[model samples]
Target: MTDDVLLVHGGTPISGEIRVRGAKNLVPKAMVAALLGSAPSRLRNVPDIRDVRVVRGLLQLHGVTVHSGEEPGELVMDPSRVERANVTDIDAHAGSSRIPILLCGPLLHRLGHAFIPGLGGCDIGGRPVDFHFDVLRKFGATIDKREDGQYLTAPQRLRGCKIQLPYPSVGSTEQVLLTAVLAEGVTELSNAAVEPEIEDLICVLQKMGAIISVDTDRTIRVTGVDRLNGYTHRALPDRLEAASWASAALATGGSVYVRGASQREMMTFLNTFRKVGGEFEVDEDGIRFWHPGGPLKAIALETDVHPGFQTDWQQPLVVALTQASGLSIVHETVYESRLGFTSALNQMGGHIQLYRECLGGTPCRFGQRNFLHSAVVSGPTKLEAADLVIPDLRGGFSYLIAALAAQGTSRVHGIDLINRGYENFEEKLVSLGARVERPSAS
Candidate 1:
């Protein structure tokens, strides 16, 4: 809790019933696909965030084990002692994330040589683990790149490769399905990233036996199998924290049930939250969202990859498009610095602007690539509260949905970077009523 400081207050409206777990992007890539199993897996609705305690402390520093599963967001792991750690405990979790470069292909297929280190995440993008070490040197490994991080080395026993990305990257297509599910023969790929958390990490690597397929255009093949085992599975329910509490229940008009929200992984963020007027219902378990009292409509949108429209649900639906009404726009074809957190929603008054080009959508690849990556946003604009700071993890939950739809007291400072993917977010923002505190140390 390094000098944590929230102290919210503001307008308030966050209605109740919250319960989304699992999927801070598919439970840390299904705990790095349980290190390409051989025995112990399990997992469940896991999500205590901070990137699942930084991939469960880099899977207990590569020996795996990681117990606890009688229920209550289970997680068993084990990985039959897949050892090889300590480069000062993998550089003491380097900058503490970028999931140790997706555990460098299940630690070079369970330890032939690994040690990644130095990687950290969430500046939103330029996400270059050099295409996860160029897809593990096209599945043959042997990397080296020193200075403190990349060393990898399979030497000989990782084959598969056909590649083709250029950009569909859901973390370089889960680092080419955790290194082509144990590389050896057929891998394919081509513009990958079919995100439903990479098709639930290809159903946790086809229940850990692997084979994989998926096509409808953005290819993917896999194949390579010699052995793989453990898997109980369950995860798959955080549609980016249920579209960030359905864009904080349409930026505070409020309703928000969310309860393990899924409506088919939130049908393109509930059809762009009902084209911005926002009013949801769904229910085979959850998805309520609200705000239907009037004027929100603006839209235009873009952010593709996965069934499209999700650059992490365009920063909590761009703080509910600043109270929507007229011109919304967006574009952001996925992280070219994710619209620089709309410059703190244009300093909380929220008019937005930011452009570089690619405006009303399409034209992407960050348009001319100068990269403001488009925005616009006008709107009903009235927000007020200021002092924010927390900048990344979906721009710190879109600055806690613009300080709970601002009007006065904010102070938001780094909110522990929204607990690195929201779980227990100050007890789910005090069970959604959200007055929020933590101040003290005068």
Candidate 2:
């Protein structure tokens, strides 16, 4: 695939309707869960994103059959012929995504061993794999850090145990869920991440004959079964993507109707958006997001885990906040390096200042640390077109939004990185009347 460039003619509002598929965070993990099943799993509403393709490749490497169903965006995964894959091929995928770490549990159950290559994701923070190995060790898996990658071997059947997270890491929680579902005994997890995607994964597992329960609090109980069959389930919509487009609409002074967006998953974001002077209408099919014909209001915001405002939603919304009437503060409590993207925004004529001290919300892990995870935006600043580089997934989309909201033209490099999360983003942008052009190959 070519690393293409997008020349965007700015100052035009992106208005129209675009539909969202399954949650990118959830669908790939659910596909990995199919390895625990004795039969084939049919997953509906699967998006054709790079992350999903990477997971599907990893799955096929482990001898699972991955193919599409009759309907569009449907994947039929069959794991009957489970086998080990070549480590070199696995290493090749390591640089593409961090998803190979998630294959550990399912591979352990099927082959009694697994190899995880050097993980790669957005350069947002230190996303260590220690939580994964620590959880695996508790379940009787022997871990060794080799020169190439981390290797694991399960001497016996994994036995469930009570585990509590030091912090509610989403990946660690998923590692526990996928491992606990087929372990020898009942596993109880406290301080688990109850994100909607996690809950959807649990629903898929339940459909596959695994018994799991979630409480009002952040506690989950899983009763391991000797065997699990395949499941047929539809995935939840991508709230992150939905909110990204909503922020785009707000930033560009436009309107967008995102089909398949769920009201329940985005309640917190919706309330926050309304507070920031955005308007929306929700119905059975989807939601319509628009700017209310006035300067957007500046509001204090904080990024947290699920049930709080999402960290992914913060980046795009910050672009809209650049057009807000007054000062807006955002304290990022998730990734330590997430605020690094603000420098590019500043280069594009947005006034955003980074600070080490947590300013707007309660002190988080990054508070007082050297990392500049907090930002204050003095908005109603006119954005000017500048050559932009795609930072991370969310940050890249935020740049696109900023470009669209700016005057004149902007050249965006590394447009391909957006494919990891957003599906057919260029096509979607074109559908919404975005004046973007991709240079042809010489």
Top candidate when judged by lDDT against the true structure: 2
Candidate with top TM-score is 2
User: What is candidate 1's lDDT per residue for 1-442, written digit by digit as tens?
Assistant: 4377787887978888888887887788888888888889898888887878878888888788897899898989888887887799778778857877888887887777887768777787687777778778878887888888778899788999899998887888888888888888999998787878889889888988899999899898989998889899898888888888888878889898888787887787788889788889886888788998878899888888778777888888888888988988888887888888888878889998887888764547767768788888988899999888876878887897888889888887878877878788788778887888887774
Per-model CA lDDT versus the true structure: 0.83, 0.93
Error of 2 at 142 (Å): 0.4
Q: List the candidate 1 regions with Cα displacement exceeding 4 Å.
A: 1-16, 24-30, 33-68, 81-104, 107-130, 133-135, 138-153, 156-239, 251-254, 257-294, 297-310, 315-323, 335-357, 360-364, 368-442
Compute each candidate's TM-score over C-alphas: 0.35, 0.98
Model 1 residue 38 CA deviation (Å) reads 12
Which pairs of residues clash in candidate 2, taking residues 3 or more apart in a chain or in different chains?
none
- 247-311 in candidate 2: lDDT tens per residue? 99999999999999999999999999999999999999999999989778999999999898989
